[model samples]
Target: MSTLSKIEPTDATEPVAEVLAEVKKALGAVPNMAKTMAHSPALVRGWLALSGALSVGVIPAPVREQLALATAEYNDCEYCLSAHSFIGSKVAKLDPDEIERARHADSADPHAAALLALSDAIARGRGIVEDAALETARAAGVTDAEIAEVVGNLALNILTNYFNILADTDNEFPPVTPLAHA
Candidate 1:
């Protein structure tokens, strides 16, 4: 159960319905999370804007997915953790073991271990990582632009994770639930 009241969908005309329509067209379904956001059109709109910004930002999709998954795990957001997990594996072709390994390691990737280490540091909210760690991330080929985008990725996941906790958004992606729980 959510601490926040569930907002049921209404067929009536409203900005929220427009957002819901866009969501439905995009996903072929009105996800419970979006529906919950429909309770406040502003929330849905904010999500849309932030999502668009992140997509157009400098981070590559794969790395952003990794950041998002890591952040969701940190927040214990069952819904988002599940959603992004599948997106990473099925859509992005990221190895399942890679994600599992990444979740616990400060250095998740053998080739790009430093980047993962930086991500882990960020996930821990250690706003002050060693200068050497930043140098390591740069050596691993992470750009200043990508670092900024990583911050956005963290923010987006934090938003969704907290929303799920507050809204108790039902899972739309089923396979992810067990993996997230484990």
Candidate 2:
């Protein structure tokens, strides 16, 4: 159970109802994160807009999922870890080993590994990654645009992770334990 109650689409009035509809359309079902965010129409709309925008960005789906997984683990947000774990496997077709490795911001691919390490540096350093880390990623072939996309994706995941942690949102996806994956 969440600290905040989940609002069902049917029970939502005007503005919120419309937002929830969009969420359902985008996700195929209304997950708890959206339901909780439905309390504020703007929050839900902003989240959806950013998510939609980033979906087509330069970063591929697999790496984006990796970013989500890495951030979720960093922030210790179980809801996000679980959600991304399921999405990473089902939607992004990440293998179990890949998924697990991503939780540590690691990948066998040098480019992905570099990006994940950069992400962790950004998170750990409070959005201020060292020049060396950026250089490392650049050396790994992560483009400036891809680096920018990483920040964007990190912001998107952090919003949900912080929101879910604060709201204690129920996990609708398969349960993923941070300790086990960590």
Best by TM-score: 2
* lDDT tens digits by residue: candidate 2, 3-98: 999999889999989999999999999998999989999999999999999999998999999999999998989999999999999999999999
Look at candidate 2 and give me any clashing residue pairs: none
The lDDT of model 1 is 0.70
TM per candidate comes to 0.82, 0.96
Total backbone collisions, model 1:
0
What is candidate 2's CA lDDT for residue 60? 90
Best by lDDT: 2
Q: What tens-digit string does per-residue lDDT give for candidate 1 at 25-50?
A: 76577767887778777888788788
Once superposed on the true structure, which residue ranges of model 2 sit more than 4 Å away at CA? 180-182
